[model samples]
Target: MTDSLTLRRPDDWHLHLRDGDMLRAVLPETARHFARAIIMPNLVPPVVTGADALAYQARILAALPDGMMFEPLMTLYLTEDTDPDDMRAAHASGLIKAVKLYPAGATTNSASGVRDFARVQPVLDAMAEIGLPLCLHGEVTDHDVDIFDREAVFIDKILDPLRRATPGLKVTMEHITTKDAVDYARAQDDSLGATITTHHLVINRNHILVGGIKPHYYCLPVAKREEHRLALVEAATSGEARFFLGTDSAPHSDDLKENACGCAGCFTATNTMSILAEVFEAAGALDKLEAFASLNGPAHYGLPVNQDTITLRRTPASYPEKIITGVGEVTVFDPGFPLNWSVLPSSV
Candidate 1:
């Protein structure tokens, strides 16, 4: 059964490989595992234009280790004033694969995000016409909304209307954490899909605060209750095309994560596929793993599925206490245990 679980190479529908030193340090981790990744654009200044995205893509390519085959699919961070002309030009140039919408103050380094959906109507309309996917951070920034309720609230107040306003727009809800999000993605047309992260599938909100404040477990669209975690697990293992892998493996220097107000994100890109294999195996759905990890994402994007294959073995492995960076080492969300599954070399 372990030998039979191997799959065609998978693409990470979502990933955060920070620029410069961090980018160099982490690119190998994700590139080692995923054939491609939908690179997030929430950099310090944010990649708000076609030019910025193109520049960022170059940096990613430069950072990759020699002999590693990894494609970094670029995305523009949409701002209220983002020019529709620029979006169309980017799509035509094939430099940009999608546009990411981060509502202002929605998550880490998202201060430059859009202040209102209405302000980006023209850009959204152009994307719909051009067939470009709008990858969303999927959380409302209202201060009054409960932290855990943000995903659900955004679905009701923002996503639904955005879908209506821009009919035929391709949307990928990134890092979905709740049952409401699961049901919403499933109900939408085939153009709409969602990315599920490794952390949300294995840990509940309680794991974040259980014995103590485990800052490493913290991430935006914070992990919800146990029931929500189970729902996410079910969705990922259900062989449903709407649900696919998106590590959203954001990395923050330890100083920032442990400070007065730690930023929101997790650095799980290193062990992402191993963690995912473990989750699906535990769910008794190993047969569906390949579809969730490999097929679903590219299918929704109208891209060809990867022909290369990768293997997953139920082998033991350990995670580091922290990954060193120039600024400071970043603590990883080590399950404080060994992983039950690991990826191995494979030939399709």
Candidate 2:
């Protein structure tokens, strides 16, 4: 058996690092393995302008633990009032990498998201012209739509129409959890890409509802049926350029998660690489790991891959059940199985 594997350092195409105390608590976990990450912009009030992105970027850098390095690729939250000129400036200045669209009320802190698709056409048009990508929370908010069908329905009713209308726009369907999403992304041109979350690839709907409710397994774009989970694994392990890693490692205090209406997220930033190594190795696709986790994201974003490297060993490793942060203790995502691969000390 292959005992150890080394690859170029990976980049998370989609991540959530909340600001202030929460940011300080979680930043090091991600920075330890990933060289960079596309930072999500869903904080309270949201980051809607170039200035907000710059300020947030500075804060992320300041909060980084000494000797640890990480680059924050900022994104702007798309709202009805989002200024096209500001987006252009942000993209041109290299502060913002993409614009995120969270159909109003779609996910956490998304009350400020876009309600009318027509209202943002100008911004979409400008983004298309400038070659900026759009990172989407690919689910609908219609009250009548079954929670499980929201993703598939969004593709047919919204994403398809939007792409038809905007000829050159680049779109990254974030944390896609359905076979329909997988097929849609596979059929699209190079302008399109999809990020498969670490947790989505590891858990399925049954993991959440099987033995009483497992709140830690719950996340937005909630894990689908086993069939869908299989599809995601196939795509992610296939070495397909359109599919890559995006550990939407959102952290919520244990108090918030165990309460009546818990927040949607999975805290996997701490062990994503190790878990991924196990998944890929299980699929007999260990050769494709680097492409999925390290190469594809940068190619899609028009950036260079990291020069650093990390190694994964076949030896067993143990991780904490929960991490104590200044805000509160946050539970780590449990894979529900023994992890045989563990990330070794950094090579760079």
Candidate 3:
């Protein structure tokens, strides 16, 4: 059995660090393990302009504890009113790394998301021309579409058509939950990539609904059937460059999560690396874990891989049951199995 492994530090291609007290509390968990992350812009007001992204980036840096360094690769939220020229300046100035599309009402704080795809064609054209990636929530909000089928439907109805109409608009199908998405991403060329969350690799619809309503297991692009879950695991462990880790580690207070009409997200930053190690080891593809978690995302985003490395040693992992923020307590994700690998302390 492998006892220890070392690889370049990983980066989370998708993450949500809500503003204020919540941000301060959860920022450290991810910074400890990742060298950087593609910060989500779905704040209450949403970061839609270059200035908004700059301010949000500042807040993220301020919240980051001293003595620890992390780069927040900020992104702009795509609204129908989004200004293409603003996006160009932001990317050119290195204030933003990508743009996010939420498909209005698709998930939390997505009210500002686009409802008219046509209105954003200008922005899409700008992105394609500049080589800036567009990260999509990858779900449609049509009430007629069954919740479970939303992702597949979005691919056929929205993504395919959009990509066809606007070629070269680099897209990352964020938090993909279906095999249809996997096949679609594979059929495409290098311009397209997909992100698989750590929780999605481990849980399925059964984990959320079987015994009882497990809110902590709940998340947007919600877990799908057992077959879908198995497919996700395979793609993530297959050493495919287009497939990478984007934990989508959204955090909600315990009170908000455990209530009627609870929010959609899972707080996984505290234990994602450990959970990923367990999943890859079980798949007998431990060797490929580095590519999925560390190498693949940077390659897709046109960024250099981190120079530092984190070593994971075989051992039981320990993490908090709840992270107490000023707003409320946020529960850590439970993988339903004891993790046997952990990030060892970096040697100075």
Candidate 4:
């Protein structure tokens, strides 16, 4: 194995940098590690149009610390009422990079999501025409489907059909957490890709309930069984161009997380690179780190690879337990133990 690995500065193809004070607090963590991030649109009302996306992007820019070079690639939240003409204009204007699909009640702040696939065909057709990627939160919200089986069911019932319907559309299966997702993405041509979250690679469903309910481990597309985790590790380390890093490092306030109805997301941005490096190292595929972390994402998105480089070393590191947001402190997903790998900025 190489003693060190260097990669083009990675882009977080999927991320959630919430608005207002929360934005100010968490943007720096993501900015410190990623060159660019595809910001999620599931805010209070959601960013549904080009105008809202541009305004949101401005707020993100204003929140960034000076001299901290990080680009926030914005997206519009797809809803039944989303106007196809507006979406086409947004992509053409270069104000938006993607359109996120969150089936109603699929995850946090997604209550306004689309209820039926047929209702949003116009917007999807427009995206296909314009060459914009559709980022999906792939879970069927049917109450009868076992929570663990939601992803696989969605793959059969929604994603596959959607892809067949819009054959020309580019798609990124975001934070994919199942073996089916891995297989589906890999079977596709380069036009389709998948983003694997750091947490999903390292933790399984047991991590959430093993020792009482660990809210920090709770995330949408919630962690799956060990077999699925192994599948993700294999897909991520396979050096396949379809797999890339998209740390869905969503942060929720501790109160919101530890209460009766805990929120659905893990605050992993603070230690994502470290966790990723550890997983890749253990699999004896450290050599393939750069492609998963850097190259594949930009290539799929049709953007040039970043010129700068970042290094991951076999060094010990510790992350804070929580971040102080204006509403309240947010719990981070560190296991409260030192990590075996650490990411250090490098001048390339």
Candidate 5:
């Protein structure tokens, strides 16, 4: 058995590090392992302009703890009123890496998301022209559609037509949770890629309600059935450049998550590396872990791979179940199985 493995430090292609105290509490969890991350822009006001993105980036930097080295790859939250010229300036200045599309009412803090796809055509055209990528929440908010079917339905009703209409507009179907999504991504051209969350690969819908209501397992683009989880495992371990890691490590307070109307998110930043190692090793694809976690995301974004490296050793370990933040405790994602693979302390 391979006792230890080492590879380039990974970057989170999609992540949600909310602003203020929550941001400071959770940023270290990701920074401890990941060299950089594509920071989500769904803050209360949302980062909608180049100025908004720049200000948010400065806050993230200011929140970083002493001696920690990390980079925040900023993104703009696409709204119906999003100014294409502002987007162009952000991209030209290299402050923003992509534009996030959250269908109206699709996910947390997405009230400002686009409802009319036609209204955003000019922005989409500009993005395609400039070679900028669009990150999608990838679910429809139609009241008639079953929650489980939203993802597939959105692909057919929205994503397919949009891609066809805006040729060469790079799209990232973020936190994909279904076999249909996997198949769609496989069928699409190189301009289309998808991000698989660390939590989705480990849990299924049953994990949330099989025995009792497990709120922490809940997240936007919620986990699907075992069959879908298996497909995510297959695709993630297949070394397909179009599929990569994006932890989507959203953090919500314990009080909020435990309430009757809890928010959607899983705080997986704490143990994502360890859990990812376990998942890859189970599929006997340890050799391909680097490609999925580190190489592919940067390639898809037209960026360089991280130079630092992290090592994982085959040693059983347990992580805390909750993280204490100023607001309240945040529950950590439980992989259910004891992790035999653990990331060693950083060496680079």
Candidate 6:
């Protein structure tokens, strides 16, 4: 049996490195393995302007502990008032990689997101012109739609029309959770790609509401049924360039997460590589792990792959159940099964 594996260092196509203490606390967990990540900008005030993106990027670099090497590919949160000139400037200067579209009230700190898609048409057009990608949260927040049905409905009601309107605009649907999403992505061309999260691959809705409520497994665009999870596994392991790893390793303190109105996220940064290794191996697609985790994302974002390499060996993987931060203790994601492949220390 194969006992050791090595590949080009990976990149997180979608990541949340919240500002200040939380950023400092979680940055290392991801940097320890990933070479770069498309950093989310849904902070309290959001990073909407070119100036805002620059400032946020500086804070992220400053928060990085010495001796570690990682790049924060910043993103501007798309808003109704977003300036096309500012976005083009950011992309031209290499200050930001993409623009994130969070439908109003869809997820955490999305109060400032777009309520009217038409208002942002100019910005979207500019993005297509400059070849900057658009990252979508991929859910509609309408009160009438069932929580589980929001993704599919959003595709029909919003995404389809939006893509149709902007033919050449590149798009990446983040943290997709359903078979419907997979089929839609498959039907799209090269300009469209999708990210599959670590948690979504392992847990279904049952993991959240089965015997009891499991808040840690809960996240925005919440996990779907077993069929969907299986579909995600197949797409990810299929070695398709259109799908890649985006841990979406969102963190919330224990106090905030285990409460009456808990936050939406799963902190998987600490052990994502090991968990992915175990997952890829199980599907008998160990050969495709590098393509899914390392190669696909950079190709999608038009960035060069990292020259460095990481090696994984057959060994029991162990990680902390909770990570302590200046804000509060954040729980690490529990993948349910024991992870047998651990990244070798030298690979870091």
lDDT of 5: 0.93
lDDT (Cα, tens digit) per residue for candidate 5, span 1-348: 898999899899989989888888889989888999999999999999999999999999999999888999999999999999999999999999999999999999999999999999999999999999999999999999999999999999999999999999999999999999999999988999999999999999999998889999999898888999999999999999999999999999999999899999999998998999889989999999999999999999999998889999988867888887778889998888888888876666
Count of residue pairs whose backbone atoms collide, per candidate: 0, 0, 0, 0, 0, 0
**Worst-scoring 10-residue span by lDDT in model 5:** 339-348
The sequence of per-residue lDDT tens digits that candidate 1 reaches over residues 145-178 is 9898999999999999999999999999999999
Clashes of 1: 0
Q: How would you encode candidate 3's per-residue C-alpha lDDT over 256-310 as one tens digit per residue? A: 9999989999999999999999999999999999999999999999999888889
Candidate 4 local lDDT, residue 108: 91
lDDT of 6 by residue, 1-348 (tens): 799998899889889999889999999999998889999999999999999999998998999899999999999999999988988998999899999999999999999999999999999999998899999999999999999999999999999999999989999999999999999999999999999999999999999999989999999989999999999999999999999999899999999899999999999999999998888889999999999999999899999988899899999987999988999999999999998988864553
TM, every model: 0.97, 0.99, 0.99, 0.97, 0.99, 0.99
Q: CA lDDT, every prediction? A: 0.88, 0.94, 0.94, 0.90, 0.93, 0.93
Candidate 1 ranges with C-alpha deviation above 4 Å: 1-4
Candidate 6: give the clashing pairs.
none
By TM-score, how accurate is candidate 6? 0.99
Q: How far off is residue 201 in model 5, in Å?
A: 0.5
Question: Model 6, 12: alpha-carbon shift in Å?
Answer: 0.5
lDDT for each residue of candidate 4 in 89-206, tens digit (9 for 90 to 100): 8888988999999999999999999898999988888889889999999999999999999999999999999999997999999999999899888788888999999888888989
Model 2 lDDT tens row, 1-348: 789888999999999999889999999999989999999999887999999999999999999999997999999999999999999999999899999999999988999998899999999999999999999999999999999999999999999999999999999999999999999999999999999999999999999998699989989988889999999999999999999999999999999999889988999999898899889988999999999999999999999999989999988878888888999999999998788888865766
Model 1's alpha-carbon lDDT is 0.88
Clashing pairs in 5: none
